[model samples]
Target chain A: MQQLDNTFTALSDVTRRAIVARLADGEQSLSKLAEPFEMSQTAVSKHVRVLSDAGLVIVEKRGRIRHCKLDAAPMKEAIDWLKYYEAFWADKFASLTKHLAKD
Target chain B: MQQLDNTFTALSDVTRRAIVARLADGEQSLSKLAEPFEMSQTAVSKHVRVLSDAGLVIVEKRGRIRHCKLDAAPMKEAIDWLKYYEAFWADKFASLTKHLAKD
Candidate 1:
């Protein structure tokens, strides 16, 4: 559950989500990952740091360059949590339908 | 995207997540929702407020009682966003399999 806390907290920002989306294709140098955004590399790096801290992204330093890669396991956990409520919603829908049928 | 931000931020706390989980069974009075936790009703109400701001939970007043209900739409949206990366992880797994095969 703490993992979910970290995962969701790290993902609450738009820029962080975009960074994750970009890294989904393949591993990228921090600079390369920062290129698509208008923000400074430092700004982007901060976002990456949040993602890394949450275990959503992995950062490896190779010489002077830092590379970022997506780690989707935490994301899978988040999805599992959200999916649990699917049954709840499905039941609500079923009940709604039944109630309407009575009318 | 802002909705996603609110949804994720609202869910980042353990107490809030527990509140959400309990509400999944059915609508619960605010006091009833706080009953299982050691926290005061005020503390639980704050958590509920955050969930309400995120549009994850709906609060209604019937007389002096507040009925809290789970709104699964935002949770569904969050799941949709996370599920987009399913393809990325699947591809990564396939590539890992191929690499292992070669070794």
Candidate 2:
């Protein structure tokens, strides 16, 4: 439960989502990850910290560089939770479509 | 982006998620929705408000009662965002499986 809370909270920002999207291709040094964002490295680091804390990202330090990697396990958990309601919503949509067709 | 942020933030709490789960069955009175939780109606109301603000729920007034209905469009939007990474993660898992098989 707490992990879900953390996962959702960590992903609640656009910058963090973009960071996650970038890291999906491959691991990146912290500086490289910060390059596309308009914010300072400090700001990007803060966003990365949230993702790391949620276990959605893995950060490793090699020499002076911090490498960020996408860890999709927590995200899988989040997807699993959402999938529970997938059928529910699908049914709702189906019924709404049927209702609309009649009107 | 803001809607995604709001949806994720709204679902960050267990109570809010539980409320969402309940609403999945059908529309529910705010008081009835608060029944299972140990917290006061006000606390549950705040959670519902967050869900409502995120467009994940629809609250309708019927006389003096507030009926909460799950508006799963926002959740669907969230799932769509998360689905963008589904293939990426699946590839990772496949690689992991292949590596483990080699070991």
Largest lDDT belongs to which candidate?
A: 2
Deviation (Å) of B59 in candidate 1: 0.9
Q: Write the residue-wise lDDT of candidate 2 on B1-103 in tens digits.
A: 8999999999999999999999988999999999999999999999999999997888889999999988776778888888877765778677455445544
User: Considering every candidate listed, which one attains the maximal DockQ?
Assistant: 1
Local accuracy of candidate 2 as per-residue lDDT tens digits, A1-103: 9999999999898999999888866789999999989999999999999999999999999999999988877878898899888875678667487447433
Instruction: For residue A36, give model 1's deviation from the true position in Å.
Output: 3.4
Model 2: residues with Cα > 4 Å off, grouped in runs:
A92-103, B93-103
The share of true interface contacts that also appear in candidate 1 amounts to 0.68
Please give the TM-score that candidate 2 achieves against the real structure: 0.87
**What is the iRMS for every candidate structure?**
3.5, 4.0
